[model samples]
Target: MKILIKMKSSLKDIVELIIQEFKTIASSYSILLVLIGGIFIYGLLYNYMYQPNVIRNAPVVVVDKSNSKLSREYTRLIDAAPQVEVYGTAVDFIAAKELMKENKVAGIIYIPKDFDTRVNRGEESIFITYAVTQAFLYYSSIQEASAGAMLELDDRYRPNMVVFLPAKDVLQIAAATPISVSGTPLYNYTEGYGTYLIPAVIMIIIFQTLMMVISMISGKERESGSIRHFAEQGTTLKRVSRIIISKTFVYCILYSIFGLFLAGLIPIIFQLPNIGNSYEIIMLFIPYLLATCFFGLAGSVFFTDSEAPILMIAFFSVGLVFLSGISYPLELMPWYWQATHFIIPAAPGTLAFVKVNSMGASMADIQTEYITLWIQCAVYFILACLAYQYNIKKAIK
Candidate 1:
């Protein structure tokens, strides 16, 4: 009977602690802004900015020194490509450079005077392309358009030797290339930048915002001396464990709603990729959220004031993006950098979510990331409890 009464008291205390944490978050304007603005406003703003997705008709200035029918036809073909448009012709390389310097074009294409001479002689021909170093999109668009035009030109000039071959052998010879190539893109059919990047960004935003909010709340507790009061409440191992649980519960519930908006509605609204199984996404998210929350709680020990979390965490936003292996492949990263993937919940979470959501991967495909998150959850939860116990002990001193 006495043990039952003790269990009831402990349960009541946990509920009260959870309510108190929620109230603290509600009353703080900074916490509310970071929680609300970072998730909704940032999500909408990023999607809107990248809505155009694909780069098209990037302008290029052509220097056609050959001034022949074939060279003019090549220029026309390049302009017709969807990736780039010829702004105009330049008489020489020097003239094209001036236009590029003026920012009149994204790139310059230089066709040598021998361009038509080489093609007529049935020899290989090459053209030089120059693009601004400021943005890679300009270079990519120019290269794709130029290469496509060159292929068409090559087909037009190549001899039709199949005509001399016997009828049966002609078909075989025509079909017989050393290798066949297909340029079709899988997963990202349109091959847009937004399609490739935004889904990963959504997961990253969830992790970053959750970290900031938890750290800010922890910082506020320390700054306002509220933690000292809480520390005076017996500071038992059991009580410290309950405090950690209460805090994690509040964050997990709030972020679940935020996660639904980010992972569900945002993709539908922006028309980004959303092919993952909803059941699988939820399964992945459960461990991700738990790991991130505890990761934040463990790191919160270092935050000296409410403002400190923002200062420290805001700098890591870009780092997190790169570390997530969205912009680059994880396998190619340096050994030391690759090791970080194991330490940061966002790294594995982003990769796993991208696979499931963007690539339509199954749960089995993400077993490594899924298991890593659970391991992090276990490890960080222990660290958070120990951190709070230390804080309470320090307060007693």
Candidate 2:
């Protein structure tokens, strides 16, 4: 009977708390919420906003002074680079520089008049281009295209054979060949950076948005004597856990459908490949969503001021996103940093998302990743529980 009364009272407090939070939020106009929500969602979608990595059709101006077949071939090779959309060739250096300065093109390549003569005479040549850091990706792709052009020449002109030196001294024939390389870029396959970026950003947005909403509301209740009333009377860890579970359930459905619709429907409509399992993506998200919610809850339960949740949530947003491999690749990171990346829930989440969606990785291939996600989820849940207590109510008051 006593336990039942405790449960009933806790339920009442929860209802009151939710209603109070709703009132506070509702004070903002609907248009404001819509605007805020749009900004919030957009932020979640475009973490590296204002300028994203949509490098396709990037502008490149070619200054072809050579007019010869070889230079034309080189110009064609530059045109073929998917990262750059070739603009009309510049008549002179002044025009090329003007185009670059006006932001009409990201870069310009100057193909000197001696281009073919130099190649035919077995002489080295130079190509000059300019790029700002923002245009670095396009610049990188151009360099790769230049390499491919070199390889094209080498393959067409050079032949391998055993050069016999007049007698028994069968020395390998050497032209003192100049070393050359070709670096062809494999594009993002999905045709846009958003495909890769959106997947990870969606997860990040969820973590940040929910962290802000839940923590502020949770913290406010604590500071306003509500947590004390609930704490001194009726509260259980199980009830608190249930509330979190319910909210996550709601948001998970909302976001999962929203994310998948964009990821799936948009790609299919545009003939782009989503190539990922909805089930696996959802499963992968389980650990991350749970971790984020409880992480906020733990902070709210511990902090004396309402602002702590906001600060802590923001700090977490930056750190966690940086570590998630959404911005930087895991393979490129230092070995120890890779290990650090693995420890976070987002690492496994994003990896699994990309594997299942982008790479079409089989479940068997990602079994270890699946297991790791569950382990991390459990670890985070344990930490949140251990760090959080029902008595947080009395201490703040």
Best candidate (score: TM-score) = 1
Error of 1 at 337 (Å): 2.8
lDDT of 2 by residue, 173-280 (tens): 343555676663343643455555555555555566666665655666666655554445334566555445544454454555555554555445433436777776
Which 10 residues in a row give candidate 2 its minimum summed lDDT? 160-169
Global lDDT scores for all candidate models: 0.88, 0.61
Model 2 regions lying over 4 Å from their true place: 1-5, 20-59, 64-73, 76-87, 97-107, 111-126, 130-141, 150-198, 208-272, 299-339, 361-365, 386-397
Candidate 1: Cα lDDT at 223: 72
Which sections of candidate 1 miss by over 4 Å?
Answer: 56-75, 85-180
Model 2 lDDT on a 0 to 1 scale: 0.61
TM-score of 2: 0.63
User: For candidate 1, what is the lDDT?
Assistant: 0.88
